[model samples]
Target chain A: MMPGSLRAACVAVLRRDLLLAWRRRGDIALPVLYALIVTTLFPFALGPNDDLLARVAGGVVLVTVLLAMLLAFDALFRPDLEDGSLEQLMLAPQPLALLLGMKILAHWVSTALPLIVIAPILASMLHLPAHANAVLVLALLVATPLLSLLGSVLVALTAGTRRSGMLLALMLLPLCVPVVIFAAGAVSAAQEGLPWIAPIAWLGAALALMLILAPLACAAALRIAIDA
Target chain B: MTAENSPSALLAARDLTFLRQDEPVFGPLDFALRAGEVVLVEGDNGSGKTTLMRVVVGLLHADEGTLYLDGAPLDRDLARGRLLFLAHHLGLKADLSPLENLRIAIGLYGCREAITPQQALHTVGLQGYEHEPVRQLSAGQKKRSALARLLLVPADIWLLDEPFANLDREGIALVNRLIERHVAEGGAAMVTSHGAVTFLHGEPRRLRLSA
Candidate 1:
């Protein structure tokens, strides 16, 4: 029987994911550092002129951060899936959607949430304007979780595909385009002192939609993935 | 959930069919488990034994057929608690200690009468080694840790796929004892294996799967 208490199952899955991240701290850190390094290359490649870097920094940071999240995403369910913990999760009486939601939330905490927290320091390195800096981080705080949620669905969908990392990026980058555009556009509008409410609202809408549907997709994908 | 008042089969599969990449795995398959009965599923290599087990557990939906648990359609939620399945892959976390692994397993199964962590350790024959990481354990020891899961909790039906895969003689004896105890208690089980199981008390109903 599925647990009478859905909330308890959700909490349980969330705790399990967090524990996984904690135990495999090295694997988790490598991706985070990879993101940091990839983001750091922007100024060096474009020359150190602060104004020139600032002009394109918003898009660069958002795209790079989104890429970083995608890079780490294949790791999200792959290890568990390979090791068969995924089957246990699937067979748990709790709704797979709810359990997947807990996992996505944990992914956000460990991946996107940390990215948002670290955005400020990276933003400074990119010479983002003061107002745009806050906007960039705020937009990322809102946006990256959406990326994580969507990435999770694709990761689950393509769970055991050969070269799944590449496939995941192929499948998710297109889906993530809107999030990348709206997030970077929000910062861009703020940089020009224009009302960026439309893009922010769009980003929020994307997040809300993904929050609702991604887990279900992930559950269905898990069924197929497990077979593979 | 289905009404407990109904005298429904604990597990049933009707006309189940499954294919992998266009190759027929199992077709027109039918099986059931009643209270106090054990079903021994036997087959040769590549004969869909594991696939049949997966389909029964709802891990893989049959390409064509219906399944029911306790008179209810094998709803994923209901099956979760009603079925205790051990796949070919032991599913033990390599990094976690055995005790930690058992705790996660208990939590996932949501067993109301779950044994204490210590009892689980003792039942698995790992009383002093519960704290040792799974990566350090021998294959048979890890298999024992998984079998211990059966002792710590109860389920409506048990599905074991190659449960004796890597066990030593003693480990095999212990597993047979566990199965005997479970059957003696009136629980149902469906196990698949390539070799004959000699210790079963009664002639278990047999189902053969072929590629």
Candidate 2:
């Protein structure tokens, strides 16, 4: 019996979550499908005007991705909390924050990565500029993770409570305002032929901060959830 | 457990009581468990048996009183990797197989000196269902899968809320055998049940909780 190290624990948890996500491959597709349907409707709703679609394309993709991410938020920690796996995770010897960080990483990879991969396609479908496509993807690359990290803390707080799906949306959407602003700001700036680096840099700074703090908040919130 | 440590009580409780909504759930209780000892916690329904077990494992903080491990105050940091808890929830992932579940536990708590996940599953009577998803297993088999975790983890203290629940006669005997082997190896355990267990090693100490 080899003693498990902190690194081993992290790897094990990451692999476990990824494997579970892979097994439930259909669940991973729901958000992508949701994003696909939502992006497809923008043209039909407001007429197929290229200017209108192009103007709204950056904002549309950002909000669509954010909302798509929200669709999968319930899967973040609720299942683990209900099945007692979260309790086991808390009881592990390693720092709870580190383990949760791993979980958050897996969540971003499975849920948001797919949406990001399809983002340019989704944006281009709305007539978003070809030159602005890189900026859109780059902004999403930073913004999606920030949303995931922030959403994890809210998910942790609402765990173990019934009817949390709506509550999660109500609470998370307000907090998502800033993330959406910076991300959409970057994309729009790029489309308007302006320097878009500042907003993306802001998103990066916030991501760095949340990447450190959100997991610690999740650890504390979940301990309280389990305690109660 | 580190070497060169002095012999002392593995676990001790002093006026340890838990309250819910300002109502007393359990004691103001006192107890101590030494190495190689098993304390049988006997209580009636809603008599704080599970509550006591949760407090012992630090899942729920005591409303009033202190708990000590190896003669030092029990805190979250110290209690982790040292205490193993198996309550009503087996804590296994339904989507993963028993083997994968055991591997996750091992990854968290580290393995015991000489046991592998496969060996632990075999010890717990889950030899043939190593890769079967835990959701497909029956209630007793799920419990057995959790029991495999007890074999693989290296924690020194075991707090089993109800080891006999949802088990057949052979499963009960299997649990007793595991406890006996665990105790003989100088590990301490506190088990709660409805007084149906008959130990093979003569008799164990009983800690009764009164409502």
**Which number leads on lDDT?**
2
Q: How well is candidate 1 docked (DockQ)?
A: 0.49
lDDT for residue A68 in candidate 2, whole number 0-100: 91
TM-score of every model versus the real structure: 0.92, 0.96
Model 2 misplaced regions, further than 4 Å:
B1-7, B195-201
Q: Write the per-residue lDDT of candidate 2 for residues B1-211, one digit (tens) a residue.
A: 2211234678888888899899898888888888998988887888899989887777787889888878777777867998999989888899999999888998999987776789889888999999999999999999999999888888889998889889898998898888888899999889887655544344778888777
Chain A only, candidate 2, TM-score = 0.97
What is the per-residue lDDT of model 1 for residues B1-211, given as tens digits with 9 covering 90 to 100?
2322245467877778887787778878777777877888887888888888888888776788888787666777656777888987777888888887776777667544645767867976888889898889998898888887787655768898877778887777777777878878878899887854544445888888766
Candidate No. with top TM-score? 2
Candidate 2 collision pairs: none
Candidate closest to the true structure, highest DockQ: 2
lDDT of 1 by residue, A78-192 (tens): 7777777888778877778888888888888887776777777777788888899899988998898888877787888777676677777778878987888888889999999
For model 1, the stretches where C-alpha displacement exceeds 4 angstroms are A1-5, B1-8, B21-23, B71-73, B112-114, B196-202
- How many collisions between residues are there in candidate 1? 0
DockQ of each: 0.49, 0.68
